[model samples]
Target: MSEKKNQKEKLWGGRFKGEAASILERIGESISFDRKLYKEDLEGSRAHAKMLHKIGILSREELQKILNGLNTIESEIDSGEFVFRSELEDIHMHVEARLTELEGEVGKKLHTGRSRNDQVAQDVRLYIRNRILEVLDRLDSLRESLYLQAERNIDTIIPGYTHLQVAQPVRASHFLLAYFWMFTRDRDFFQFAASTNDELVLGSGAMAGVNYSNDREFLASELGVPRISPNSMDAVSGRDHLLQFLFAGTQCMIHASRLCEDLILYSSQEFGLVRLPDGLTTGSSIMPQKKNPDIAELIRGKAARTIGNLNHMAVLLKGLPLTYNRDLQEDKLALFDCVETLLISLEGLEEMIRELEFRPSRGERSLKEGFATATDLADFLVGEKGVPFRTAHELVGRLVSECGEKGETLFTISEQARSAISPFFTGKEYDRAVSLELSADKKNSFGGTAKARQIEQLKIASESLKTSSRTKE
Candidate 1:
């Protein structure tokens, strides 16, 4: 029997008879970062201890003492009174140190059929599972905010853009619902990440099946894991669940960055289409009349770092042949960093959007400069003048260019000038071409730019938010 002073004297201390180099220890240590996993590690240890007792590996009285001692330590940690020692190496040893302090000989029995490798795999999964749920809740809140805004703006017309140039008219609600759908896909990605965390990795015994006749199913159930990992080696070594979550985080950040870009561009003096509230904007240091959209810009820039984190994880896992390796420790910092970045970005964006005020008159003026209603003219020519769509399209193009040459709008062009471009042109055709009402109303197809379709989409988005909130609860 070997009894050691601490973790440095126990498992994994090969090759060093003296203390480790300060730099080496700091690089190898995960406690400062992984202390966040203390709760999950304790939950896993409690489940393993209960299973050990059920299999007659420990006496009933010993099980009671271990369980009771574990509960006390949990309370102390939550109250912030527990002291952590870097000498313990990690949470597993730190918790075991406390258990041994309370239960003496019985605390030694808790390690009968486990290894730190599988234990750490369990802890990371539990942490990611919980964090993904938290992100999903935030996403649902943002979805609801957009849904409410859509409901209010359904009738407001705005210029649709292609290559940052006004292309046509769109309901403001329709543009908002685009984000609603983006968030819906984000929710689905989170659901996939959570589902991948459904298995138990305990009882895997480092890298092989343990010799003990352990009840893995019982251990899995006690840990709230849906099923035991089928292969002990894979269970101890695998990190696909973390990768799945990183990928999902990348998707979310990408969507947020795009939205941030649009908001920043729209709020610029050149666009003059939107005004970000004071809370979300900042003033230039030397300029007296500058209100910069700094928050939106930061959100957009941080997304690149988040995406880089995901790529780092992928490249790290790509070539490793494993049971367990020190390389896996990098997963914690990467994941924690990415999730924290995402949450802050989401919070700032939600606030920015809530305070967003669109300038409809400015938007309408921009829409007019593009001869944006020409598509409506083309459609009318096809329907009423019995002209082929291609001909109507060509004729509309000619009318648009002629208006440009005359330095006038489509409405301001003379009747003779319009007729010179196309015999299909008439008073009714000219009126329909500039009618914003007809442009928006004629687009009533499901999922179109029409106000009615946008309203229906808003109702659907609202229902989605309510259902997702209840699911998270």
Candidate 2:
């Protein structure tokens, strides 16, 4: 009788007469990580219990008891007094087990119209939905930081690079806004991910519809979800929502990684275009004069982890059979890690951007050294001298080569060399063409690097931030 009671306490152990192997318990337990879903799990139970009472499967008294019990458990967990046991296998079981202890057999009825399969699915959707909002908020903050810096530096010029080589002069605002746009797209991706997870899947019991006439729409409403899953089998089995979220996180992190790369490179002594805040950097143990951009470097490295997590989730879902399987337990490891990584990275990157200081003089020096205005000179030939673009390009290329061979820059190139390249190239025309400030300002086309266009872009970005904030509210 005692053995039977123990087996019964296992929840799904009714079919078995033998005890589970200890090793099986060790390998099968998910309460360690899935405990992060405690709030979602408890909330799901409260909704499920209320739905059970609505369908007359549970008494009003039982519903009240279950709700009270769940509330107490939530407090216990919140106060760090809850015990997480591997023997319970997962959060669902732990929650149910605790509820049963508190409310007697009525606690068992909490699982009446649903299974852990759909329960976990619902919890993950809730988790993803909440995390998407957080990511969007962080992205918004970072975008604002970028916008503010751009506004402050509208007149600041920097060398824009292609293939890691300086290609042209651009407003610092333009350079910063480039990242602002990348994160804007990342915010859109996260919003899509949130939409994908909006559907409530709580009514999907295991892999099939339950016998009870439960009101899933009510459950959806209680859970603050906008829609209910249409098909039971797909609802419990599908992991597409999680995949979309992971993909969004991966893309956001990739954008952050790119930003970090620029920060790292620009902060280096070799480039010296920007300086990281001391609070965001670290000192090397062996070097007395080293203030390393470790924060940015770590964010970049963690992006690889987010990418790997996305791949991990994709491969985990690839060969699985329809419906929930034990392998699904592995999903939270990647999901939780990616969420944590992305949130911290976003915060770190935002702080870094907020504190970053740009050296305009260094940027101007790099532009001169790299012949960053060569294209502008070429354009001058085409636009001013009526030289065909191909001829202008060739002429500029020759001038650049001659400057390089003579150990001079465009700013230092002699009048003799300018005449050798093109008879139209006088010292005044060449100087005007190569002026970094003039080159940047001349790009006055829509979305160009000119101060006028950057001001327009900043206004647009500020409006976008306002819209996003309104939507968030």
Candidate 3:
């Protein structure tokens, strides 16, 4: 039967005596996932065919037939008419098989000097290169969402926390800008990954140099890459570019998960710092009052998978003494998974952030009980009263404890009780020292949460976003 012959007719089966068992064939098959690389495979093949024709490997008539054949195959795959066969193995083999079916001998000549090893290397680099640019766009969109949100809430003050306890008051814009900087770094990493993919690996056939007079640099230009791999062995064996993308994806996911964690906490009724939009939240089936931050919670949980994928690839390559090994085939699994996971998380978080509604009043009013301005009081004592910092710290600590015991704010403390520690203490000075607005304004050093500094940061970030967008950075 044709099905029976298909198993023994594999491209690499010339030396084998028998067909692989069905289970082994199923185990080795990558068509299920690597089919996603069809576009890159087709692109590389066309470039290879053109290079062959330029060097007189194929006649003018044969090159035209090859081009038409490849175009038809690409259309078939794009229009959902292409049939993927497990027997053909990966995206590359499938494309070649279809090309041969279309153009006979010329299609067969397409693989004249290239090996699947180098072919797949090129395909992965191309795919990752495209994905790197795509992820940067998403990151920029998310940054824009945060930027607009920060602009809208520029003067809105809310408690800032350290160790889960309120430490000081800051503009809501200042808080949002923190995430802008985090993802800016992530964008830089993706750009680095893009630069790493600039080398061509297509001419490094089967882990050694090919015999053809192929123009690797010309092929690089056709593929929009800047250079060719220097050594064939390293070109075929190296996967550091894929690793760079995976590592960048993992770090981005980590940052996104941390942002989601903050969203989860802020949306909770206990904190009530932000309100989740009804469309982005879920309600409990049993509890009438339950509204959950399900999207953010899911993002938080998905981070473990990305972190695991990064580790999986790192460990997969740790022991392989490879010029090229069969084990490398599984690298696509991690790369594809990490890329998709990060994209989904980025898109979802951007939507949630765009719809987020902050409840600044609730957070602002809680600053007194938590003594968020205590440090300001200490600073005033140190500068105005010349009290030793440690002495001022101890004095503030005792007063804070006493206020808590009496179920009162520092402003409510008796003047006699406050002055007992220092002769310079007075009601006016105490009120000014404990003022939350003055406390935040006092943070005027660079990168601080002072309102003026936040405005300056916002202007710089907005301009950076505009420049990067125009330049496609």
lDDT of 3 by residue, 1-473 (tens): 22233344887777777667766677788999999898898899889888998888989999899889999998999999999998787888888889889889778899988999999999999999888888998999999999999999877778898998888988888889999999999998888988887789998999878898888877998898888899999998898988888889989999999999999998887788899899999999999899999999888888999999989899989998869999999999999998898888999999999999999777766787788888888889899989999999988888888888888887677888778866555778888988777777788888887878888999999997998798783
- The lDDT leader among the candidates is 2
- Backbone Cα, N, C clashes tallied per candidate: 0, 0, 0
Compute the lDDT for candidate 2.
0.90
Query: All candidates' lDDT scores?
Result: 0.84, 0.90, 0.87
Candidate 1: regions farther than 4 A off: 1-19, 411-428
Question: Where's the lowest-lDDT run of ten residues in candidate 1?
Answer: 1-10
Instruction: Judge candidate 2 at residue 200 and give its lDDT.
Output: 90
| lDDT per residue as tens, model 1, 1-473 | 33224325644566557655555555667788888898889888889988989999978899999999889889988999888876666888878888888889788778788888888999888888788877987887788778777777777788889998888888888888899899899899889988997788988988988889999989878978887799988997788888888888899889999998888888888888788888878898899899999998998999998899888898888887867888888878888899899889888888887779888887787777778899989988888888899999999999889888888777678889988887767677568766876798788988888777776777778778878878877
Model 3 accuracy (lDDT, Cα): 0.87
lDDT, candidate 1, equals 0.84
TM-score: which is higher, 1 or 3?
3
Model 2: CA > 4 A from native: 1-8, 388-391, 416-423
